[model samples]
Target: MPRIGVLIDNNTLDDHLAREHGLSLVILLDSGDRWLWDTGQSGIFFDNARAMGIDLAQLSGLALSHGHYDHTGGLDRLWRETDFTGPIYGHPAVMTGRYACSCCSPPRAIGLRTVNRQRLASQLIPVSDTARLGPGLTMVTNITRQAGNFEPIQGFYLDPLGRTTDTIPDDTALVLETGYGPVLILGCCHSGLENTCDHIAVNLGINRFHALIGGLHLKSAKPNHIEETLQTITRFGFSEVYAGHCTGTHAISSLSDALPGKIHPMGSGLLLTFPPSGHSTT
Candidate 1:
């Protein structure tokens, strides 16, 4: 069996923990393989981990979803506050600068900050394509847009001046091979969940997934976009999707209403067990 712990998210599973507009997850396999997914927007992940009795330092390795602040903000804290000195995994573009420019507000740097870029560069192990981490775990990247803009991206730039568009090529996911099927975990599927699913199916030869977890990045999605996502999940037979963080309120309501108990909220303090206790929304 395997379990996934929610270290940071936009909401808390209960009143005892805190909430933030970010995301982090800890993956614990029965084989003693522990992996930290993301770091959230601050050192809050550390406090939450301590409260939940999880040791972030005692992990095999770290895999990043992308270069966003919300996903990698705690890197500096992890460097200064913990004994974690393992390898950091992600696409090479994950360290590139990212910004947002829209409406009247000036373009703002939204990529990883507070952490020393040079220090991270020294530790980052680029996973440009799917890399097998263990017997049943794989780091998935190089996501392509086979579907027609399943999630439209805008207002994001690679440079501070907002001249070049940032397609978030570094966005990645983790795949866990299981008896039932493969499980897809994401950091913020910027390439679009539909695209990510399609990539795995076409490239990795995985069709049906046992479960789906992580942020969908649909905070500001339109109704049709949500419907498209619903169809995507149905198309892939993803029975349980623990979505949170950037998944947003409107999208959550729509997804939950459409899928009933199949759609569950993921946040801090939540522990989802699998391989028999697969759908325990605890």
Candidate 2:
């Protein structure tokens, strides 16, 4: 059996667990290798991991989903708290400057924050294209925008001056093939879910996805927008969507109404297990 522990997220299943406006998953494979997918906006993820009985020190590796501060903020804690010396996988543009701008306001820095740049750079493994991490596990990046991916990744800039739009080329996802079926894991999902799924289908030749686990970046979207996203995602055959973090309550409600028994809200301290039978949450 494979296990996925929600180290931290926008909410916590219990009051004892810490909550944050970010996402992090502790992936434990059947082969006994432990992998970390993203690291919330602070060291709180580390504390939550310990509370959830996860051993981060023996991690096989760490894969970043994007360059956002919410995704990479806990990285400094990784170097300071754990003895983990494994390679960090992400796009080469993960270190590039990123900013968030608004009407009549300055662009705020929202990229990766670190304590030791040299050490982090030394352990970085940039993924310009799709790559397999282990048996039945793959990291996908550089999503194609064709096939009517209208979900806009707006309000972001490549520089503080907002001269150029930041398309977030570093946005990536992970695909894991389990005994039950394929699971697609995301972080923020700035590339748009439809585009990411389309890219996977075209490049990997894997048409349908069984599960979708992570943020949809639809926290502030209107009801109609969430409905449209759900309509497009159904094409991928996802039975369960563990939406969390940036996926707002309104979106969850819309998902529940649209998919009935298929919607699952993610929070810190929640554990998702995949046995030969299927997937379950606890």
TM-score, per-candidate, Cα-based: 0.94, 0.94
The global C-alpha lDDT for each of the candidates, from Candidate 1 onward, is 0.84, 0.84
Give the range where candidate 2 is weakest over 10 consecutive residues by summed lDDT.
273-282
List candidate 1 stretches off by more than 4 Å: 276-282
Q: Report the lDDT tens digits of candidate 2 across residue range 1-282.
A: 777889999988979999988889988887787899988999799999998889899998999999889999999898889856899999999889889998978779999888777787999999988877755678998888764464556889998988899988889999887766788999988887878888888888877878888998887776666766797668888888899988888878888888988888689998988864233210
The TM-score obtained by model 2 is: 0.94
Global local distance difference test of model 2: 0.84
* CA displacement after TM-score superposition, residue 57 of candidate 2 (Å): 0.5
Please, what are the lDDT tens digits per residue for candidate 1 over residues 1-282?
878899999999868788888888998877787888988998688888889999877788889999999999988888888757888899999888889998889989998876488888888899988887655778889998765666546789988788999988998988886656678898888888889988888877878887888999888887887988999899999988999988888898899999988898788999877673332111
